[model samples]
Target: MSELGKKIATRESYGNALVELGKEHEDLIVLDADLAGATKTGIFKKAFPERHWDIGIAEANMTGIAAGLATCGKVPFISSFAMFAAGRNYEQVRNSIGYPHLNVKIGATHAGISVGEDGATHQCLEDLALMRAIPGMVVLNPADDVEARAAVHAAYDHVGPVYLRFGRLAVPVFNDEATYRFEIGKGIVLKEGKDVSVFATGLCVNEAREAEKLLAADGIDAEIINIHTIKPLDEKLVLASAAKTGKVVTIEEHSVIGGLGSAVCDILSEKQPTKVMKIGINDVFGESGPALELIQKYGLDAQSIYEKVKAFVKQN
Candidate 1:
């Protein structure tokens, strides 16, 4: 578990990864809708001033520009908050990027309830749902700094429209570079168990790991799987785990209606039927508060997950 005490934000890793990528790829261009500092594209702006573009709060126009750049053989990474980047510019992304299938990487930061003190308007709980709806869009939600760093390189290498989700809170680092590998559409099993399979994505992956420990203490061996990619999901891995455990619980920092929970249910309903429980926001908007407080309120915290899983395991 990250050598026991290292904590880093996924957004911090995204920004630093951009600097490292800038040194290698000359054709890599970054565009931000005047949120370079908040979205952490400021790191790229400082490293390669000529390659970075501040589009001044014009999210839709930024997508258009990135698409145009992509046509000329440039790999453009667009940066903005998830609400504005994915929600505000949905039409542009769908038509300009998705339709054309351009080489554009969208780095969406401040996603979900962890956006803390920003209230419902700033918090984006439906980004995964929105981005996943767009055809050919690669949706990536990195669990920690190490995965976030690797995801940046993977997105840059892949040719198509991609959405990279990053969080504002500093979560515990559970993966080490020496042992961890990031692959698009691949799920990583952190712990193997026979009782129940706990599928989680983004910041909730760490909570699932903690919940695993709590469940183990109570004689429940919970299998924990980290789903870093939401769309083009690892159906084989998910179905195999669910087949073994027979009980499933999905955790995410998104709306329960159309996020990782819905994605898992969609798979299970099609192939193998299993009793599933989804742990996320219950079709409600988030309020202004500390990140940890909001997590507890939404029942996405480790303790809450543990209690819910313990009950679900008993019932099933």
Candidate 2:
């Protein structure tokens, strides 16, 4: 329970990191738009009551408040449901946080169709695309708890607007605290191979790993790259992986359009001419079910990756 364990959520990692980082950085402040409990920022509020602000349910005002605090040399981490933080407060985030490029960290929880049982409205599938469109926003979707904690530290040290996407449902904890390191605008080659590169983020990274095992068993070697930071995309690393593997596949719990897949295509179309494939949500809304069922239905699960990769390997 202390260190990395199986089937852990990123929210828990952020909850622990906020308390740990709050202890060292006195300037670290937290703002929650009535989602202190849900977003797991309540841990920080329990200790640093003075530094934590529960801004009611007004997400737009919360962004303005965070931006205002950033001007005074305070590094504020705003926590709320992803739909509210990124979907509802787009202008506030864009005009206030993104325009000035404030040192505000946004912990956008419950992203993608995996935010099941809450239905499509609550799930923020287009968050990465929205955040990526912002001029100075540094968008991130960590692979697991270890990367989640590490990204929190990196975001704290980073000076600018940061959008952190986390999941509501727990997945396999595939990383170790000691073995992993976080650097902004970089991708990690998890498993090296020469055929196809599976570039993924968020929970899809876990699915991609599982899919890799299936592919490897069939004698199809696949390279896996963890794209933690999406906005300042590591295009060079992506192109290099594509060049080395010669085939690219992107997996994400987001839309096929304007998400991780689109980001990878933007790079490969210019530098590498490798054939790329993507597995993600189509142009449709999510529904109520178990989180895993929703991901599987939306083609954001391991089976989808396996099918897509298998087809790609055959075509190649």
Candidate 3:
């Protein structure tokens, strides 16, 4: 495993990637809903003034414009908070982009309760479910800086609507930029073990790694796999891991109802029947608080995950 490196938010990586992609892919166009600053699309805006536009808080309108641009042979990327991009613009995205299968990339930043004190209105826990519900939509939730940037390139290469979820909180950069490989619909095994498989995504991946250490102290050998792509999930990898361990635990920052946990359950329940424990936000709304505090209070912190997994292993 690569050593843990500096912390960087995946949302920041999304913006930097757009600037680089714009330099190479001239057909690439960026559209923001008056949140270029927060979404970090302003970096692309400053670099390519003519190619980027602010739709002025009209997320649904921006979605339509992006779809129209896609039909005209332009690869348009729409940027906004996950709530507005995936939630508020669900209809436009489903009809305009998903229906025709347009090559439009949706960069939904500040997802999950990790958006800090932005509260429940801005924090989007249902984006994965919403995007996954759209037929032919490619859903991706990258784990770190390297994976996030690579996902942007992958989304551009994919010839259909893609939803990319990013976070506001800075997470540990554990993957080596030069050596790490990022592929859509593939999961990476960060650690190999035999007792149980701990599948994780987004910022929760780092916390899972930390929990792995605590689990080790208790003589629990937990396997860690980063499920970066939620939709088009790495079913083969998931089944292989579950077969090896006979037990599974899925961790994510979003709600357990329709996120990574649910996707994992859908696969394992059908092909490889195994014991599963889901660790994520319950079907409850988030409250205003510090990002780290919310994560802990909601029982997503490393210690909380460790305790829960330990109990699960002991009980089962």
lDDT by residue (tens digit), candidate 3, 1-316: 2235888888889999999899999999999999999889999999999999899989999999999999899999999999999999999999999999999999999999999899999889999999998999999999888889999999998999999999999888988987988899999999999999999999999899999999999999999999999999999999999999998999999999988999999999999899999998899989888999999999999999999999988874
Rate residue 16 of model 2 by lDDT: 77
Q: Where is model 1 more than 4 Å wrong at Cα?
A: 1-4
Q: What is the lDDT of candidate 1?
A: 0.93
Per-model TM values vs. the true structure:
0.98, 0.97, 0.98
- Name the regions of candidate 2 deviating beyond 4 angstroms: 1-5
Candidate 2, residues 172-284, lDDT tens digits: the string is: 78787666778999998899999888899989888898888999889999998889988899988898888787888888888888999998898888777778888888877
lDDT digits (tens) for residues 160-228 of candidate 1:
989999999998887888888889999999999999999999999999999899999999999999999
Please give the RMSD to the true structure for each candidate, in Å: 1.3, 1.2, 1.5
